[model samples]
Target: MTITLLGVVGSPSPGGRSFAAARALLDGAAAAGATADVLELADRPDPEAIQRAIEDADGIVFATPTYRARSSSLVKGVLENTGRGVAGDTRAPLLGKATAIVHTGATAHHFLAVDDLRDVLGGFFAAQVLSPGLYFEGADYVDADGIPTLTDRARELAEAHGRAFAEFTAAVRAAPAVRALRPLL
Candidate 1:
């Protein structure tokens, strides 16, 4: 079975750092024999369609740019639309699905925002989120034709994370029986 990885980017700009990172991650996933695509929230995509895409994907990468030591509002909005709060609804589409959280910030101070996302995906959605989520700061980028771009090291790391995410997602999909082990709440 072919694995499909979906990247949900929360950047407001199309070709900014967040988008570039997502593309690089997808590139690595493709190299690993998995198909990948990105869903940019800036385009004001339909919530229902986003949920459907999430359901179809084998794994997901939630990429965002940290704003004031937190995830962008765009990311928050999409997650809210895709899955309701655990106490309110049982719509946990991310259940048992592997996920990777990626974030870029003006400084390293906001790296913990990635952890916040990880908690929501794992604690609320029951997603198998990957550890040591990728974080890149403004300094990690260089001027490429007067545009911010990821350094070679950052790009390589994102690609490696993508490869790992693909392998992990494939493993999770293969072990459907493991879903039975989840809590019955």
Candidate 2:
């Protein structure tokens, strides 16, 4: 099955690290035979369009830069708005869908930002949260233009994560037995 992956970049800065990492992850997914699309939160997002994208996607990758030890407001806004639709339903629209997160910061101390995202995604939306969210620190991979360039190891990890998420999404969509057990609320 062809999996649709949505990469949401929440950084307010254009071409920031989080956005670049998201693109890299998407590229990896594309190489694995999955269809991937990008949505920039700073581009004046439309709630309807965001909802449509989320509903259509089989997997989602949320990427953001650490700001005050939390995710960017833009990213939070998009997720909060989307969560409203699935609030009380046993089977949320995002439930059973594979999801991953990526965060970037200037220091290793900012690793907690991923946990902040996890708390929101896992607590509110019921998304299948993947472990070990990719966290990049320092400027080793960042370019003068503020884009991220993954090293060989980083690329390998990103590709593995993408492939895993894609496979999980496919299996979840294909197995009726699994689907029957999923909580709809």
Candidate 3:
């Protein structure tokens, strides 16, 4: 079974840290034999396109740079709009699907941003939010090509997160309920 991993970059600045981190995660997923697609929010402003992508994806990886200790408006807009559709359904469109978050900031102080995203995504959308959200202290860890030069510990963390996401998606797809939902997708 093929798993679609969609990465949504929520940084307004072109080729910013958030975008780099999102690309790294996508590359990691792809290297692991998962099909991955990336949506740069700066390039795609239409909510319909984003919602369609979300609906079509098997798992979502949301990446954002900390803006005032919260997600960027672009990210929030995508979530708020798409989330509205799945609000009432116990089986949210994103429900039972794997979700991983990545956030970057100039300082380690912005770490709370990931927790905030996890809380909202878990409570509102019912996604299986993966733990240990990837946090980058600075953009230097990721080069211009979007390759992450992670330290041993960081690389291990990222790899573990990627594997967990892949495994969760595989398990979800194997479930009877998810199998029933596949026809509709």
| lDDT on C-alpha atoms for all candidate structures | 0.84, 0.76, 0.74
Higher-TM-score candidate of 2 and 3:
2
Q: Where is the poorest 10-residue window by lDDT in model 1?
A: 176-185
| Clashing pairs in model 1, backbone N/Cα/C closer than 3 A | none
Question: Between the candidate structures 1 and 2, which one is better when assessed by lDDT?
Answer: 1
Tell me the tens digit of each residue's lDDT in model 2 across 123-182.
Answer: 666566778788877643736454567666766777777777677767767866653343
**Residue lDDT tens for model 1, 1-185:** 89999999999986788888888888888889899989998898888888899989999999999987677899888777765324676565687888898899888988898889988877767788989888899988898997777899988988998888889889988988754334234
Candidate closest to the true structure, highest lDDT: 1
Q: Give TM per candidate.
A: 0.91, 0.85, 0.81
Tens digit of per-residue lDDT, candidate 3, span 1-185: 77889888898876777776777677667767688888989886587778778888888999888888888888898876764233264334565566789988888888889999998776666666778688877634645356445545555666567767777766766775743332122
Clashing pairs counted in every model: 0, 5, 0
The residue-level lDDT of candidate 3 at 182 comes to: 23
Model 2 earns a TM-score of 0.85
Question: Top model by TM-score, which number?
Answer: 1
- The C-alpha RMSD in Å for every predicted model, in order, reads 2.1, 2.8, 4.6
